[model samples]
Target chain A: SQQGEEDPQALSIQEGENATMNCSYKTSINNLQWYRQNSGRGLVHLILIRSNEREKHSGRLRVTLDTSKKSSSLLITASRAADTASYFCATGVANSGGYQKVTFGTGTKLQVIP
Target chain B: EAGVAQSPRYKIIEKRQSVAFWCNPISGHATLYWYQQILGQGPKLLIQFQNNGVVDDSQLPKDRFSAERLKGVDSTLKIQPAKLEDSAVYLCASSPPVNSPNEKLFFGSGTQLSVL
Candidate 1:
């Protein structure tokens, strides 16, 4: 079972436009991570925000986390056509035996039209 | 640094057929994972290995699915009598010991399986 659920099953936008996706989780987590997966490709780690962090940024990507609401959002500014891919939010929970179990969300498919 | 490697980019089989997929994680990584991803859904963890030992396999369907990590470097997952529902992309990911919450995971391209 997935621990997180991403809002907006899919999104489409023109090139140079911004894209925003949201994720919500049910349980407390040690951290939350966002990943990108191109068609027929494996997931690529984008950014990670610790539970204590409220916001994080990487290049044109910005991430915000709200522990109180158990939600997180990812924003890509001036998105390019290459940014088209499926975005997923994974929650990292500290499981027994000193291992971190990261559970993924259903994912948000994004399309950037040129 | 070399990334995780998986073999047989694609596979097609009929019901009840047996098949296996291989994975070689990044060198020196201590943790390895296998996830099954159906189209349009997120990847689901099937098993996890920590240095040749099974850390978790709670989600694995032991009746037909089995995996083994030998010498703590390479792993293989096998399915006997595959079902159509078993068709999905099998992904291999590796990570170093997770002492912190900010650790990153390295993933392979994954094997696309089709069970008819």
Candidate 2:
């Protein structure tokens, strides 16, 4: 079963605006990572926030995790046309197999209009 | 460093035909994964491997799908008598050992399969 669910299945914004995408999960997670996929390209790892973390930032990306709600959000500041892509959130759950099993959420398709 | 490599960027076959996809992960990575991404949906985990051993494959349809990482470096996923609903993008990813606390997966450009 998919562990994460992202809201606002699609978003369109003008360049330079901020884009926020939200994700919610049902189980305890060890970590949550975000990835971006350009059209006709592969997934690129964006940022990862551990369960103990409240917020993390990388470049123009800011991610917040609310363990109490089992939810996370990704924010892109001053977005550009290059930021147009599908965003995904993946959860890492510690399985009895002694490793973290990863599951992905339905992605948010973001379009940055120039 | 070179990223994960996947072959046959696209494939099309009639239902009930057989097909195969291959993956070669980044060097020295001990973990590999195969995911199936149906159009308009998130990628779903099909199988996972640690070194040459199967780590997780609970979601794999054992009756039709099979995979192997014989040498622990490259892996292959094969489907016999494919179904129309099986059409999806087959993605391959690799990550460092699970002990690496912040390990991230590197993905390859997936093989897009179209089962007619």
Question: For each model in turn, which proportion of the native inter-chain contacts is also found?
Answer: 0.60, 0.60
Tens digits of per-residue lDDT for model 1, B2-116: 8899989999999999999999999988789999999989999999998899988999999999999999999999999899999999999988766654377889999999999
Provide backbone clash counts, one per model: 0, 0
Best by DockQ: 1
DockQ of 1: 0.70
Interface RMSD of 1: 1.2
| Every candidate's CA RMSD | 1.4, 1.4
> Which docking band does candidate 2 fall into?
medium
Residue lDDT tens for model 2, B1-65? 89999998999999999999999999988889999999888999999998899989999999999
Docking class of 1: medium
Stretches off by above 4 angstroms in model 2 are: A95-98, B99-102
What are the per-residue Cα lDDT tens digits for candidate 2 across A51-94?
99999999999999999999999999999999999999999876
